[model samples]
Target: MPSTSIESAAVDGRARTPRFIQRQLANLHKAITTNAKIIQDAIVADTGAKLREAQLEIHLSISVVKELYDNFSVEEALSQEYRVARGQDWCDRNDAVGTIYLRPQSHNLVYSIVSPLANAIAAGNCVVIESNKPHQALSSKIAEIILQHLDRDTIAFVENLPEPPSKGVLLIDQTGEIPKINASSVHTPGSSARVVALVDRSSDIVSAASSIVQARTAFGGNSVYAPDIVLVNEFAMKEFVQAAKIALSISIEETKGQDITASQATCKIAGIGLTEKELRGSGANVVMRGDLGTIAIVEDRGSSLLQRKIYGACLILHSVRSLDDGIDLANLQYGTVAPRNKTLLACYHFGAPEAAKYTTQFIDSYASFVNHAPIELTVGPAAPIGFHPSATHRYRPAMFSVPKADCIAGDSASRSLASIFRAEAKAWSDVYEKQITSSLAPTRQKAGKVVGFFDQGLITGFVVFWVPVIASAVVGSGYGIRAGIRMTRS
Candidate 1:
């Protein structure tokens, strides 16, 4: 990887117009869809992932290119480019950040590379993808496809980082480790962080179990979004465990007899039953294990499984006393004096909306899901650190761009501090006195229904009590009037 190549790519990226970028993305999309089968086969060959999983990765990869192409507008881009010349303020304007260095993860190699590559190109950036795994079938195939369709000057696949790394380069590192290079980077530190699923008693046990099992076993359980451990409410433990066993059994049976290469041997699960003494000594008890995955129960918080990341299809189940207990367990990091907040990669809260909201509020994670673990998350690289996770794509176009606002109009609401400073001492005193004497306006109430459980119960009681009584009184009065009329007639 020559330093000059990246430099040339960066220069070319800056010169690329929105139309040119859009055309390139369109070509890439066409190329991917045309060669979808080859890509899918390569994915399966490299990762030993199921054919369906490979198909999904290919589909998602094509979607990335399509999404970028569809969302990009040549008219809006040109307008922003010449906003200042047209004497208009371009608020919230962003320009491409030149070259993007992508280090993709290996779980879903096709999706990992395609997502950032497409986003960077759509944002008018040149890309330098680090495809060091040339021996990998998926990597080589991706390089072949990308190079054939994309502009050569604007895109280069290098096995190593460019020597004497350039400044102002945006590094998208999905390899988990924070890049040691001296450049602006959007690295997902949480890729290596623990992802925990909290299953409250209020949650649907069957749904939670199904989701947990699928997420844990999908794509050989290499997804970073897969829950490293599950914190089931103590009250729901029995039912949850039962449901999880059924789900895991079904998943294992589905993937039975699939080819397991030497690389995938680690993902295989063998059934084992540990005694009470063994469970306490080991801090984990394997309840269910099969060809596809394993399910273990970890009652001890100090268990090493709770402290570290689980890369295979092993689901660690722990009983939590309450929502607070789940939160506490989710924040478990070994060797920390006090539990750190917001250290989790992602939190999956399986409960009622109220319980999920409470869990999310107290637990700090990069991403939080209420009920389901998204299958999309099991494919692409984790969202860049400090940015909100997108439900559709891994990296947004804006992440590859730098803020470049053009201001042509003055702000009317901005007060002049100079005017206040220039005021005379007596004027300042008068202004201070006026401010001190002025009554503060009351805070406006928040909009929408603010009713709580007690309030709702009271309203229900009022309606239930008054409606029947009122109806009875009206009926009795009508009956008496009818009888009086009959007596008068007689």
Candidate 2:
């Protein structure tokens, strides 16, 4: 059996090469555009993803690449402007210090992985990648296209997520691996990198129910991202169930076309809510509605909310009595959210300003507001953009303490440390350490005997060399006395 260490192969001298890095990214951009026709044709041809979804990914990847390039270029211009405006203080963007690993969802390579990889490589990282699925003719074709442009070794694409050949975890002996993205394996980004996980909670209960109906009648409800669990606030359970029933009722009639099992084994964990119909279709037990929110999320109790990365539209609602509860939930579940992931946290009487502040604070992974402005702007919050990495969560970016280790704009350390330090310095002052302090005083005399010293109540001793005790005793305290005695005797 052969074993492969992907990062080891790509990393050289603890980092990646820049010249080749830029070239690969530039080529990737061209490849994505060049292969757009093939990508769309292949996805549609293969029936893996919806054509529009595939196309959207292509567009998004291109847009992101362009955005990253533009951002870097603008930063350069800004530096020049600053130099011109105020002599030589301006600074321009330079090559970054470490590698960025882009781990994308399986089956959707073009949008999720490739585009992000291009951006990461452009930022100057030697990249190593793994494909989510293996033996797909479409993936093979795309990989060939990508390989033509970039160095094969610089960008590795594992056929699928399997243990290293030597790890002894045989594929046949175990429960099969799911076709999903693994966030932990990507390089840590030089001890100062940020890692974000994206998830979309069950966004459409109506659609989920309808899909279940369709699947039961047409196919099966064994699809990824299907609403596996329904977490509603115990208070809102009735309202949520009513809303879901209404939504499903509308969907059922609209299609007049499907049979959804709303009862089977709706595994209702203590706090998780689900019915027999929902559980019949769920891969795991659903969390029931309870008197919990962000705070509950943080305290992983037996009957609390779930915090693992959830994709697809498995709706998990956490009921909260107050805004503070919601934010506490966000902090607890910070590990679960990512950019572009969507889910709803409801509050009945909250206003937008308070909504915005709280949502911004709750921001994790990618924070978004679906139906209404995050907090229900009608009575919720007005700020559209939800939570961002911040102090309450202890998220900050790297400070780039040294010139050589220039930090990326949104790296992990920056989000957890630098960001927190700058935003909540007063609150976190006691924990901050000063870089320099006065030296300690020596505690030994020239006589070689140990001398003692006191410093702020700390006593310390050290030994030092001196003349013999007999000689010192004879000569010490007698120089003047002996001289006087000699004079009197004369």
Candidate 3:
């Protein structure tokens, strides 16, 4: 498709009424909900996801469309449109970006595409999706549903994005590559971004193990939100490892009757109980391997496993000395001169509230969860780069729009420009001289007893030295007087 077609469609999208956008979103929701079963089946067939997982993906996709539809109100839209005309200020007003070009990932195929697609439509932007993976059943099904429900002119699907992409296009790339096109883009770091989990000594071992295990094993464990490597407090490592073993066992048992795809089965490492020395040569020790996943303990600090993101159903564990140690390890980049900061996709801090706070304060991640990884994140594309993830929605409507505030009020300056222009030089000079001549004294603070460690140590030393000397002097004086009294009596 030519870039001109997309540009023209964007022009038409901007001209659409709020009512039309709402109706189209509703149409999408109905179509998705009506064909929920087919979509779920297609997801499983294409991705080899379990039936239950596929069902959840379909459910989340429908919810995305429904939420956008329900939040949109024609009356509010009309009010926003006429606010400036009525001589009022619209503080939160935003205009839709002209066009949204989506390059979606295959992870959770339904939710990944539907999320941005719904948000774009709801925000009144034309959409152009890159759906080149027709070999996948889920991709074809999604393209079919979208084309059947949405207006043909407002949306288009191409095998590839137009080269030298049109200016002012909003590109949403979930495929993880930073597009070289000339447009504003939102793209995930893809497999390069890592999600880390910190298990403090104060954390609930069982709960942390359960949550991390489930996250690592769900949907064949390819989720971007899954823990790439867990940093467990050294004191808690023993208990955490035991808990994780039990959790993994229970998870595997739950899926015993379910079909295991060849890809998922291949993720399991054959030999268990491999010695640390033997694995140290290879960088990781496999503690246990099962049909569902493998649990490995990282032995090397500079291991590639610690530096890169894990894409399979494997859980990697490493021990840290303390919360600060965990932060250091989390920030460690194998070959970089400086530690990684603000580069993690997300951090799951499983510990007491204070420990969690400390971990989050020092470790920079795009999003931080205290104890549990929200299951919703496992279903959608990683939150777009430079945008925070929503608790409810995967992609927010604001991400699709740009701030275009409608302000009618005048600036709140202390003095009017006309008044300044009319003021005499003597008046201005007097004001300036008064301001400069005024005394600027620092405020007094209340005095209190010094209670720092060094101060306390000094006080303790004084008492320790003087008490012995004073007691000895008194005792010597009494002994001398007693001796003198006895001699006089004799």
Candidate 4:
């Protein structure tokens, strides 16, 4: 286990005052503002994040914290907001969600620490964050600033990886610790824990192209979100292929010599299946050319992107003659299947006459939300645009991989991942059953009336942290329990 330590401000065991809470919130705002430069410096020094990227991540984190502060101040959480929306909306806007844990990894110090932590804090849950990465000094500085600003009860920025000994309501695991999340597999029967894995697809062609050109290629072709393959539709194949070729040139030109060399080297790797022409292109990793178009590896096969919640770029070119084909293709890709409102983006000449039918068919079929544009669907939470369907619910994050890994590479990745998930599910199920029995089992166990079931946060947290480390964990862990009258209502 990593070494753990606490910086205690209180000498006695007593809790602080409400006035203190207000003061702390204020101080937190100030600390983030004051340490802006320090934080930026620390992020760049600790990790290789460019000064600009560091600044944005830090800024966003601060903004999220501020949003949380505004919503969760003693007054706001107590005073309920209007109840226009029901369960989903209620959960979305409420602050009573369980505790949240934010653990950032070493390399991308700023993102790992800030993104999850800020989002958790914004959701009105008490937060405990771990800031021990490659840049311990920077992390420590950040922790110090956070601690100085927030109230002890609402937020705890800890130096320990084990956390503050307080069972997390939920954990935002920065480290890819899949086994810990899926605790029930090999040892037990069923799994109570659930996890949400976020993967930004490089298959989203428009966004991938934009990222390559606009976003300063911070991750090179190494981003998990970088397109593994451009699945072109039949209708858009010719144009998309031409555009893609051009885009590859632009990417190579922009990336200069960095990616093209990798692309060439990748072609030479045994069974990599890269074409000489593609090797001469900008895309790195394996580049396979086919009748439809090309599938660039973007990065090495099954790189770390598969493990982390990909929030970068993906460029996929899909040409479809019919709407059904589009949906089939989407599902074929094992797409995240998010609300159409949040899933698709319209780029370049996408909304034009040629692409318009494909776009309209998708929105109509999926019933997505469309603010503007012709062919667009929302994938995640950023925003919904274009002709999105009215029924904009049922959105989940998409997961994809790079290089057309044939039977060997593909099966290798899948089998290992599947085995890990299976083990984890079994372990968690046993623990969850035990908790239920203890909670409702006539004996007066301190576990209390089974108000509900499972730590919603913990379930999701486990998934986030443990899935990749052990994919089998996802297999047997879907079991859940319902609260009974024997349980006291909260």
For residues 172-204, could you state the per-residue lDDT of candidate 4 as single tens digits? Answer: 443334335521111110111111111122134
Best by lDDT: 3
Each model's total of backbone clashes = 0, 53, 0, 67
Q: Least accurate stretch of 10 residues (summed lDDT) in model 2?
A: 374-383
Q: Return the lDDT, model 4, position 58.
A: 62
Q: Which ten residues in a row have the lowest lDDT in candidate 1?
A: 266-275
Best by TM-score: 3
- What's the residue-level lDDT of 271 in candidate 4? 26
User: Model 2 over residues 194-304: C-alpha lDDT tens digits?
Assistant: 111111222333333333222111111112212222333344434454454454445335533322222111112112233434433433334332211000111132332
Better model by TM-score: candidate 3 vs candidate 4: 3
Once superposed on the true structure, which residue ranges of model 4 sit more than 4 Å away at CA? 1-22, 70-99, 105-108, 115-126, 132-138, 151-160, 163-168, 174-218, 221-227, 234-238, 241-323, 335-490
- Cα lDDT over the full model 1: 0.79
Give per-residue CA lDDT, model 3, range 1-490, as digits (tens): 3456667777766424798788889888988988888887777766678888989888888888988888899999998889889988897987888778888886787888888889888888888888747335667788898889877778888878675356657888887888887778888865578889999989889999999998888887878788989999988888998899999999888888888863364233322223446445658888888877778898678887787767667789999988877887787652112765337888899999988888888787878999998888787778877776764576887888988877786565644644654699877777778879999887777786669898999989989998899999999999999999999999
lDDT of 2: 0.38
- Root-mean-square deviation of each candidate, in angstroms? 9.7, 23.3, 4.7, 25.1
Note the Cα lDDT for every prediction shown: 0.79, 0.38, 0.79, 0.40
What CA RMSD would candidate 2 show?
Answer: 23.3
lDDT, candidate 3, equals: 0.79
